[model samples]
Target: MPAALADGVVTRIPTSRKVVALTFDGGAGSQGAASILSTLRSQGVPASFFVTGEFATANPALVRQMAAVGPVGNHTWDHPHLTSLSDTAVRTELSRAESAVRAATGRTPRPFFRFPFGEYSTRTLALVHASGYGAVGWTTDSLGWKGTSGGQSVDSVVARVLAGRTPGQVVLMHVGANPDDGTTLDAAALPRVIAGYRAAGYGFTTLDALR
Candidate 1:
């Protein structure tokens, strides 16, 4: 992410296998939630969702389903930029998100967190760690949230994914849509992407497993 992490923010796993972790960010409502979940379930791929407190509270069914399958990570209370908040404010945000996920899924969120906007300061990192989570960063982002995840084109998303993929990498994709465009690229492209990875002899794993 920033060249190096003086604190313990993990961008990729330290391994040399063809194993990749696909993580989804669901900080808002359930826009493409069904498609993403169905594809992941039908394809038997594992993922970790970093859901905000607002998201979990708004979509309890989706949150429960996610928790039933794999790990969920805290994404803060309302997708606030943690760098702008005080240390107490940051802890409160994380705590609220953790509590929300726990309330929805009957399990505490995994001790992992993702900062809103991928913006974090040294103080933010220290605060998250103190709150009992290893900050989750990404090696390559799918950019699916920008415009249908990339540019209102499924092919573009796949192309970007194939071009940037590497062993032991953490791929970031989102499960919501842009309000203006109503585009969600990753779901439609997921099966093809999965097929592509399988064809190339790559295997899938969850971030929790990777860590």
Candidate 2:
């Protein structure tokens, strides 16, 4: 059954080797998306993006560009916390995102779904898989969501990412800006982060490559 396949919602892939997946979420403050994409492209690195429906619809051109270079996944309709919604609502959210992603990329997104705000429950998990997506979680959060506000600077964001990184770790970042001052550090910090990882001998891979 799909539930069995989606068991426990993958937080990190089980691997002993020195590999990590770099992933970004696209939602509200996606104006910095192009820069993030540019950094990824310039590095020739593979990554994954979990974008909301509004993000895909509002930025179709950016969506297509990301799809060409990295795999895309459903991040829900409007970045709602699934645990707050009924099972039916959860399904609706995921389906709407799927539809948007498909429209933008002309392909069904990878069957990877991430709960908005990293919030989920058993019922939400079952609903996610029932909607045909494997719920994805993170082992390492870039806290890039912190951006330059929330008392965290660009250097702090990079430090947070470097500190939590480990083999088989899945890092979480955002293509959006901070909700506070609308500061966007992800694009600026990504190139340095990538370079740091390479220096540390950590290889990058996409989520699809994880499984």
Q: Would you give me the overall lDDT of model 2? A: 0.83
RMSD of each: 3.1, 1.8
Model 2 regions more than 4 Å off: 1-5
Per-model CA lDDT versus the true structure: 0.82, 0.83
Clashes of 2: 0
Candidate 2, residues 14-127, lDDT tens digits: the string is 777788888889989786788988888888988899999999999999999989887899999899877888878887888899999999999887578888888888888888
lDDT of 1 at 62: 96
lDDT of 1: 0.82
State the lDDT of candidate 1 residue by residue for 123-210, as single tens digits.
9898887787878889888777777433558888888887777887888888888776888887777888888888888988776664
Question: 139, model 2: CA deviation in Å?
Answer: 1.1
Model 1 TM-score, all chains together? 0.93
Rate residue 198 of model 2 by lDDT: 88
TM for every model, in the order presented, reads: 0.93, 0.94
